[model samples]
Target: METTIYHYALCVSLTLMLFFSYRFFFGRLPDSELYRPYRQSRRLMGVALLELSANYMVHFFITPRAVCPTIAILMNLCTYWLSVWLFGSAMMLLLDREWVSRRRFVRHIVGWVAYCLITLVLWFLLPSRVSLTALPIVLAIVFMAYAVRVARKVFLTFRRTIRRLDDYYSDDGAAYIRWMSVFTYWAVFFGAGQGVFTFVPDRYVFVWIISAIPFYTYLYESYSNYLLLYEKATDILDKSNDADAADEEQQTAQNPSQSVADNVNCELNARPQLVMSHDQEVALERGIKEWIDKEGYTVGGLNIADVARATTTNRTYLSAYINTHYQMTFREWVNMLRLDYAKRLMRDNPELPVAEVARQAGYLSLSYFTKTFKDAEGVTPGKWCR
Candidate 1:
C-alpha cells in the first residue's frame, strides 16, 4: 500500500511540475506572434506531459494481470520515443537551427523505431525482468552517444557564431554560453544517471528525485539565457530603426537642396548596391573611428550594433561601410583595434603582466589573446614588450 501511494505521489508531482513548466515558459509568449521554435517546444512539452499521464493511468487504473505487462511495455516505449524526439528537437532549437538536416532527422526516427520494435519483440519472448533490463541499458548507451554528438556540434556552432558577432566577449554573451554549457553537461549527467538506475533499480527512487532537481534547474537556466539573447537582438533592431529615423530627419533638415539629390540616389540604388557612395562611406568610417577612440570600445564585447547605435547608423550601413572601407569582417576589424590598444598599453607600461594586458585589451581568454597577438604581431606579447 505504501509503495502504491509513493508511486502515485511521484507521478502526480512530476505531472504538476510539467504543467507549471509549460505554463511559465510558453504562457508568456504571445500566441499571435509566437516564434516557430518556441511553438514547437510547447508542443513537445505537451506531448511529454500526455505521455507521462498515460503511463500513470496505465499503472494505476489497470488491474488485469494478464495484460498489464503488455500495456506497461507499450506505454514505456511510447514514453521513450517521445522523450527522444523532445531531446532532438531541443538540440536543434537551442544550438543551431540549421545543424540538423532532414536526412539526419529521418535517420534518427527510423533508428528509434527499430529500437522500440526490437524491445517489444524481446519483452514477450524473454520472461525475465533481468533479461529485459538489457534493453534499457542499450537504450541508455545510445542516448549517451547521441548526447555527446549534440554537445560537440553545439560547441562548434557556438564558437563559429561568436567569431561572427561583434559582442562575443560581452557579459550577456558569456552568460549565455555558460548557461548552454550547463545545459549540455546536465543532459549528459541525466543520461548517466538513467543508465545507472536501469542497471541497478534498487536505488531508482533516490536517483529520480535527485536528478529532477538539476534537470529542471539547468533546463530553466538554458531557456532563460535563450530569452535574454532574443531580447538583446530585439533591442538592437529597435535602436537601428530609431537611428535610421533620426538620420533621415537630420539630413532633411540640414540639407533641403541635397535632400532631393539624396532621394534620387536612394531611388536609383533601391535594388541594393554593393558599394556605398564614397563621400557617405568616408564620413561613416571617420565617425565610427572617432566614437571608438572616445569611448575606448576596443575593450572586448564591442559589437557593430553597439557602434551603430552610437553613430546613429543602422547595422546594414555600418557593415557595408566597414567591408568596403576596411576590407575586413566586423570581428577582424575590432580585433585589429584591440590588438593595437594592447600594443600601446604594453609599450607604455612595460612592467604590466601579459595576462593583465590581455584583460585590459578586452580579451576574455588568455590563450585566445596570446594566439591572436602572435598571429598579428608575429611574436608573443612578452617578446613584443621586450
Candidate 2:
C-alpha cells in the first residue's frame, strides 16, 4: 500500500517538472533572435524530457510490469537511447565552425547515432541467447565509440563557441562552458544511475527520478540564461547554416567559402595565407592602434564586431588578427587593456571604492570584474587597491 503511494508521488513529481519546465526555453524569442541551433536544442530537450517522463511512468508507476526482465531491459534501453540520441546530440551542434551547414551536423553526429540505433533495434528482434549475451559487448563498444563522438562533437562546439565568445564580448557566455562541463558529468552519473536502478530493487528508482527533477530544472535555467545573455553571438554561430539568414547564407560555405578553406588548409598563424594583402594588414594594424589610443576599449560591452568596422575588416579577419598578433583572444586583449587602465586607476585613486573603480574601467558586473582581476593578478581588486 505504501509502495503504491510512493510510486504515485514519484510520477506526479516527474510529471510536474515536465509540465512546468516547458516555459524555460519555449517563451517567445524576438524575431531577430530566433536562432535555429538554439531552437533545435530547445526542441530536442523538450522531446528528451517527454521521452524521460514516459519511461519513468512505466518504470516507476507500473512497477509490476517494470520488474519483468524484458520490460526492465527495454525500459533501460529506452532511457539510454534518449540520453544519447536527443539530449547529447542537441548539445553537439555547430562544432568546428566559424559557421556550419545542417548537412555537416547530420553527417558529423546524426549518421553515427542512426547507425547505432539501427543495430540495436535490429538485434532486439532476435530472441536468441547469443544476441542477449553479446548485448553488453556491443554496448561497451558503443560507449567507447561514442566517447570519441562526444569529444568530436561537444568539445569542439565548446571550443568554437567559447572562442567566438572571447572573440566578441567579455561579458558574454564564455563562462558557461564551465557550467556545461558540470552538467555533462552530472548527466553521465544520472544516466548510469537510471541503468543501475533497473537491476536493483524497484523503490530506489524513485531516487533517480526525484533527483532528476532538480537536475532538469538546473539545466533549463542555465541554458535559458545563456541564451538570454549571449543572444547575438549564438544567433550568428549557425547563421551560415540557416536558410532564412538573408542572401549571404544562400551563397554560403558550401560553394566558394568552403572550397577556399578546404584548398588552403593553411596555418592559421601565417598572415600571408590570409586573403588580406600586405598594405591592408599594415593599414588595419594602424587602425587598431588608433582605436586603442582613442580609448575605445573603455566603452561598456565593447565587442570585436564594433571595432571591426573601425578597422575596416570583418570579424573573421579581426578575430584572426587579434589571435595572431596579440597571441590572445579578443576578450583577453580587451581585458588586458581594461586591467592595465584599472591598475592605474587603483594606484592613482587609492581612496576610491572598488565598485567605482570597476565601473570606471567599463566593467558592468562587479563580481565578474573581481573574478577576472583575481584570475589575472592573483589578487582581488580590493587587495590590489590596498
- Most TM-score-accurate candidate: 2
CA lDDT, candidate 1, residue 96: 52
The residue-by-residue lDDT of candidate 2 on 324-377, one tens digit each, is 888998888988998998999989989989998888887888898899999999
lDDT (Cα, tens digit) per residue for candidate 1, span 1-386: 23454355556556665664565445666453425555555555556455655555555466221244334444454455546465545655544544456787687678777867776676668756744456555655665565566556655655554433432223234334456566556655664344444343322443453445556555655565566466554344344346446655665686666556656766664312334577867778788878877845555656566777788665556765666568876667777877888899998999999999888888877887898889998999999988
Best by lDDT: 2
TM-score of candidate 1 versus the correct structure, residues matched by position: 0.53
Ten consecutive residues with minimal summed lDDT in candidate 2? 240-249
Clashing pairs in model 2?
Answer: none
- Determine which window of 10 residues in candidate 1 has minimal summed lDDT: 166-175
What would the TM-scores of all predictions be?
A: 0.53, 0.72
Error of 2 at 140 (Å): 5.9
lDDT of each: 0.59, 0.64
